[model samples]
Structure formats: C-alpha cells, structure tokens
Target: MDQLETMTCSRCGGSGHFSYNQIHGTRCYGCNGTGKKYTKRGAAAAKFLSDLRSIPAEQFKVGDLILYQGISHSKFVRITSVEVSRAKDQGCYSGDGEYQQVKIQCEGGYGAYYRPGNLVRKGCGAEMKSEQLRQALAFQATLTKNGTPRKRAT
Candidate 1:
C-alpha cells in the first residue's frame, strides 16, 4: 500500500486557527483543525478488493478460519464450503462483481455468502500483521513521559 501524503492546510498554514471577522477562529474547517490532510483520494475499498483478488480461490479450504467484513458487520468465521461460479444476479455488495462465491457457516448455523477474496485466511499471519500494525500506531499516538508524542515504529 502506498502511504498518503500529508498536506498542510492552505488557509491556516499548518495552524489550527485563522483570523476571521477580527476574531480568532476555533479551528480550520479545511483540515478539521488538524492542520494536516491526506493528499490521496480515499480508495480504500478498491485497494482491499485488489488485495483480495490477488489470492486465488484454490487457496481457500473447508474448516479454514476466515475474516469477513460486510456492510453492517464483521466476523471471523469457519468456511463450510467453497463454490466457484459466475454470479447469476446482483443481490448485495459482496466485495466484488466476480462470479466466485464462498458459503460460510458462522456460529449457531447462520449461513452467509461472500466472494472468496472478501474472506481473509485466519491464522495465516495476515490478521496478526494487521493487529500489530494497529497496536504500533496506537502506541505511537500515546504521550511520553516528557509530554511529547512517541515516535512511530519503523
């Protein structure tokens, strides 16, 4: 994934405030008072789909743990079956318009359908790697003893 460039607020010049009507403004609406903005267009969903497509359908197997994030919810489920077929009709957003679909049986016998790429193989180190990255980012946001932000992990 490419890192998004940080842009300074043009109006505030990196300051969170600007003079308006001869009064100090509370925040810069342009950057939401952060004084920095992401320069790239937010295409996270597209990136995720691309990453998922890179994994072949043959890689999935029954009894394998997988992560599925739907429009309303997310879950780690056990794969009950894998079917490779063309999509008959558009029903819901299952990550892509691809024909391949995987039938997953979650806890309590609840069944759901999804694209194979929408499911991330659990215990394949992918989940752990993302979790570690999240923790590292959170840790970096914490204040240090000197009241300064901690340096981000390399």
Candidate 2:
C-alpha cells in the first residue's frame, strides 16, 4: 500500500484544542495538538482496502452488512438506506479533497455520515455469530439458582 497522506485530526477537528470539561480545554492527544493527522493511507488507497472488506457506497444495497468506521466498538450492522451528498471543507485533512459524503442507516435505527472510503464491508459473520452465542451461554450460566448446576438429562 502507498504511504498515507497527512490529514486533519478527527479528534481535535484540526484545531489542536479540545475541551476537557465545561470550564477547561487541553491539547488533543491524537495529534499532540498539531491540528493535523496522517491517514493510514491516501483516500484512493483506502478505497482499495475498503473494497477488500466492504462494498463501496456506490454499490451498497439495502440489507447489506457493513462496519461503521467511526465507532469504537466492532459491530456489523445491516444497512437499511444510503444517501450521498457533498461535504464541507475541513481544512488540511479534508476528505478526498472532493468533499463527498455518504450517509447510511443501520438495522438498529442508528445513522451516521462518512466518507465513502471510511465505510468498510464486514466479512466475519461467523465470528459475530460465535460472539453472540458466547454471550448467551454466559448469561445462562449466571441464571443458576443457589449455585447448583442444572442436571443433565439421561
């Protein structure tokens, strides 16, 4: 992959300043208050990576599963709708330099806007299913009464 280009810091919004509380502000940790950040790769290169793991917005369809890049947790969501629009310039780290925006709706009724290159297709259905199964089993284990294990059927 080609080296990533320098982009604005998503955390500080390229301002080099962030609020710590209602009364105080501090330098952004993500960029050391530099107001700029480097992309892991350029937008075009990022598209290639996204394509390997996710379908591009131009090709997205209803009911397709996708991974939202802006969230902290790794969760695959079913896409319910897609919208395309123009984005405003964000200083030095602006997306694609073309300002294109893509909005997506998930099955859980949550929605967010992103650059097309930021959205990736999820490729781990089995992993997600297994995780759900594990959680279910753990919940079942917590339901035992008086510390007694459930008896097995003969």
RMSD of each: 11.8, 17.6
For model 1, the run of ten residues with the poorest summed lDDT: 40-49
lDDT of 2 at 18: 87
- Candidate 1 clashes: the total is 0
The lowest-lDDT stretch of 10 consecutive residues in candidate 2 is 139-148
- What is the alpha-carbon lDDT for the whole of candidate 1? 0.55
Q: Which stretches of candidate 1 lie over 4 Å from their true place?
A: 1-58, 83-101, 114-123, 126-154
- What C-alpha lDDT do the candidate models reach, one value each? 0.55, 0.63
Kindly list the per-residue Cα lDDT of model 2 for residues 29-118, writing each as its tens digit.
Answer: 788789987454333333443444555565666777777655457667888998888766768454576577788898887667767766
lDDT of 1 by residue, 1-154 (tens): 2332356878789987765543436677777688986433322322333353334444667776566666778666677776665665476545555466655565446456656655344534577656544544343335344334557689
Error of 2 at 9 (Å): 32
TM-scores, all models, native as reference: 0.35, 0.39
